[model samples]
Target: MREYSYFVYLMASRWNGTPYCGVTSDLLRRVVEHREGAAEGFTAKYGVSRLVWFEQQSDINQAVLR
Candidate 1:
């Protein structure tokens, strides 16, 4: 079986601006997508693209609970 890792991340539009929280397996790719506005959603609308914080988890449950 393949090993799986998860992440909890925080994104921001600008310093002292709006904040966004997310979880993903590929943090780098996800952040890039947000910056490029790949999806027409909350992140794109508010321009929440900067990766300000992140944490990795070995278990999905652990990631979500915190």
Candidate 2:
């Protein structure tokens, strides 16, 4: 099994458009969920699904701080 650290990420509605900041352990899955509208919230409503930036961290605290 592959181990993954927490990730701080930014999702954009479009190029240079609205940006949504978030943290997750599974970036791929989380992004997919956002794209498919699987999780109800701001990202789903605003269609902020494109991944703009991401940073990996060792722990949740660091991910949150980033």
Which candidate leads in lDDT?
A: 1
- lDDT per residue for candidate 2 within 1-66, as digits (tens), equals 666699999989899877999999999999998889898888878888899989999889989988
TM-score of each: 0.93, 0.88
Q: Write the per-residue lDDT of candidate 1 for residues 6-66, one digit (tens) a residue.
A: 9999999999889999999999899999999996889999999889999999898999886
Candidate 2: stretches off by over 4 Å: 1-4
lDDT of all predictions, in order shown?
0.92, 0.89
Clashes of each: 0, 0
**TM-score of structure candidate 2:** 0.88
Return the lDDT, model 2, position 15. 93
